[model samples]
Target chain A: MIDKQVRTVAEALEGLQDGAAIMISGFGEAGVPAELIDGVVAQGACDLTIISNNAGTGDVGIAALIGAGRVRKVICSYPRMVGSRHFEERYRAGELELELVPQGNLAARIQAAGSGLGAIFTPTGYGTKLAEGKETREIDGRQYVLEYPIQADVALVKAYKADRWGNLVYRKAARNFGPIMAMAGKTTIVQVEDIDPLGTLDPETVVTPGIFVDRIVRIADAGKAAA
Target chain B: MSAADTIQRLDKQQLARRVARDIPEGAYVNLGIGLPTQVANYLDTAGDYFLHSENGILGMGPAPDEDHIDWDLINAGKQPVTLLNGGCFFHHGDSFSMMRGGHIDICVMGAYQVSTRGDLANWHTGDPDAIPAVGGAMDLAIGAKQVFVMMNLLTKTGESKLVEHCTYPLTGLGCVSRIYSELGVIDLGPDGAKVVEMVDNLTLEHLREMTGVDLTMAQ
Candidate 1:
């Protein structure tokens, strides 16, 4: 059995270099690996390509990374949030690049990458500006646009629970993209609230198995002792 | 009174009520952000309907009490909401699959303009001044089995949102099936814009004059 447990955030993020393509899992504030991201910020890597659903809001999550000038480009569904001034300023000044993908297409592309498929045809984004410069075909009298896979060198994921083997179980809505990001990353590091004992989590309830996860770190609990 | 007179329009809650009355029982619905989110507060809980949020929530309920609000639980708009008894949450990818796989029965969204031929433009005005945030609008427009648009009939400058052709960038071509405005609701059928119903104190001719598009009253 592989022992993927690591003592701290730094050890989980070993070999992370500049200009790496990374997937930071989250939907708004939910499911964000804050400790791992803090490690990346502390490491001060630059010119990274980050993919997620939103471009981070306020001083939390990906906004902190953007504030550190770490992200050169962001491929996401929603780049503009209510108080996301960092990305807005950078984008307006042409200092940053944005790929505004439709939400469903974004997921399918990432899934295709993990499944070892070269590309996929999606009915979403057809006959819109998003379809521009992409190959489109009509299958069964319906229009579909061809989208490529989105693979990442590193993925920072968050989960509620993990056993010694790195199998994961998520907490409610916080499971947004962690499972899929685990599948698409070459190095999948997950931060969990608790590291359950071996066989503590039911086999059927495991959202992401141990094979997809590379390392596991237990984040310090806020206002309480670490689990 | 001349056509230039200030015609009273339905407020946000009233427009939401209008949209709520049209939802059928046992239908799985997706509500877009902004004004469309208000429709949830008006839905009859006695009916069997489920709300889907693109942010990975199904069976989404109305805004929760401030005391009971959970930060980890939110809708696509990032606002705190309640989850009904049958509510379940999943990954964002699976949420989009439910949206794109034609599992949604209806999707109600806000729009900048909707053409008579059922073309929709909501994401961007194509103006250099605006920031483009498309979100999940494109998926909802084409992927939902039926598309419903809810917005003012005219802009703040009084230009008709129901137009001969949309001036803004199209969100989806010929995807809108129904439009709900403050003044009236019109169906974009194969024939043309058919008037379904109207607010009190408005006429078919007035709606026609206001919209600048030919309006046929539905039988």
Candidate 2:
């Protein structure tokens, strides 16, 4: 039952199928799961419905998936890369279906979904074109805003070190969407630098629980030093 | 203490009034993307009321004058924004962790239905026709210590928007503490809904007549 055989991030991501709603964590390259992205690209998984904070600068993070022509739809907030604007151009050209979300809304929607909330409301885009075709209600006598859930089928996350049982801790920006999306998905696969035995991690720092995670792949420093 | 002077019909000037009084010195606030954004327009803050945008901007100031609206510096809504003198850029994730972690002191947001029980249902009405986008309201409602709602008193159909229970999708259950309306200020506290003040010339009965829910006067 124990598979201690470690692999590259790309080797681990090599088996995904089509039409998977994958949630990848990271604000940018800071904590982008290099192996996870490489794996997804190596596998050539297509028709991917990606849910993340951003698509990252092209040639990095989830943008690599976009570059591989593996992503079918992107449910992200911002997709602009610094200088290389072609990925967005490809999206606008209908090569990729882009579903933009307000950054906060995107995070909350993911949290709401993970929490089993039927729905949540806010006035983020009230009285604008964004509020079009939305249900308007009167409460106490004032108008409020509304939105729905954002669930994922597969969540790709990176952690600094994870107990084999899947307790995760992220360093800084790499922690962005991991813990939340870890709870918000059906199958959460974590790629980490070190995999430890149970009871090794401090309870307070273990931000994610073992129950939310399904798979883990360790990226050894020696094996990934050149990468 | 005077009802007529304490609360006014939150017109442009009245909203301007609340914005001036409610925001204290050296506060960090996020003007919730829409009507709550108007708060920035009425600040008497001679120096700072650091604004946080979930889109990763901190130390945000007010909307710039018509001529200075910068394209690169935008708020969460993708609308152009201006930063205060000491503002700087950082990771968006840190901005959100600050939001969800309760580092934020106050948040001024718009509401659809704030229950007498203080439940907030502002995201979606859950109607078949309306498509709601449940955003960070849940995070802000639960994350902020004191949640202040700014809203109009009626729907376009003349129905009250505040209610006993939120019928639409909820942003957060029982998160609202106070509401600043076109009519007056209502506090949703432990005892029930208490009217701290009324819009000038607007009587309790008149307020009741305009609302679908029962109105209990403040002690």
Candidate 3:
């Protein structure tokens, strides 16, 4: 049986070590794998490097992880939000490091890693401070900055549903970053609301194929908890 | 009458409506957070305009009522929004591709400063105490086909935001195509800033003095 289903968040988070580069899939609060992140906190892995679109808001998910002093650095497009006091405090106190990339570049870099590309030339961030140290080239009369791939040791994803074989589908705008993070992570662990039986999910609608996902754990009440 | 007393400036809603009127029909638009988001309310609902939120929604609708709010379905600003009919969602990679790939027609954004050459400065003020968060500003600045900026012509201290050159960090070089401000609408090109229209009682000479940049009447 090719079952990727795990019984608990702890089982899904196994082998996550200190200093691991983990991608937390989300855009702000939506699509964030809060249960998995809470599991990571309980698992006691420190010095983690987190990659996401936003640092986190309020005292939950990434913000809680950062507040716990478990993260050493964050590589994201936007690390500041209304309730992101935890990240701000650590950054100002010199406890956490930040690598800010343009939003498009951030998505492209992760996609490049997943797609197994060497590098990409993008118009975003060209002729700006974000591209200050990056290489530049003119392509067909347009300037582009060279951006490299961003890989991760682990990816924590939240999905609406998944099959036993790990085929995943997401809901609405909450789908952001889940598919690409699934591909880029060496070990992608997903927290889903429901795990359907094998062959129940139509292959045509599968957003993240089972090949990219390593572990699946169903947090049955996650949808209600997040609400 | 004093110069201040004689001048007329558009309120935020009026400026938003003014900017909204210029959006072409059937265009795909991205409204940046803050002042630019207000333009959505002023857009012609009868027109076939698709609102793109960088958070992976297309055909995005206005803010949902409190009873229908869903936390998962939100805009880039993290505000609750409704998805219109034919709306769809995708992952971040595809969402940004639509922006950076030149598929979006227009993007309205708020800016701190704009130069005569259409240079944009809004992401960072270089304040040591301020936490710099670029978000998708740089991408939207350079990605959209037509970058329309909405801002006040002058700061509260009376400093001109339309300047000879931007003193703050540049978001993108010469990416802004037009600007809609409280004082008037202006277009930028190789010839420099051209005044499209001004509020009632606002003279070109006075507007020039207020902007601190050379302005020509649009042909």
Report the number of the highest-lDDT candidate.
Answer: 3
Error of 2 at B132 (Å): 3.8
Worst 10 residues of 1 chain B by lDDT: B1-10
DockQ computed for model 2 against the true two-chain complex using alpha carbons: 0.05
Q: Write the per-residue lDDT of candidate 3 for residues B1-219, one digit (tens) a residue.
A: 667677689999999999899988889999999889999898888877899999899999998887788989999889999989988898889889998889999999989899988999999997878888898999988889999999998999999998888989899989999999988999997789999998888899988887779999999
Per-residue accuracy of model 3 over A22-47 as CA lDDT, tens digit each: 99999888899989999998999999
Indicate the TM-score of model 2. 0.56
Between candidates 1 and 2, which one is better according to lDDT? 1
Please identify which of the two predictions, 2 or 3, would achieve the higher lDDT against the true structure. Answer: 3
Residue B4 lDDT in candidate 3 = 66
TM-score of chain B of each: 0.92, 0.87, 0.97
Error of 1 at B182 (Å): 1.1
How does each model score on lDDT?
A: 0.87, 0.70, 0.91
Clashes in candidate 3: how many?
A: 0
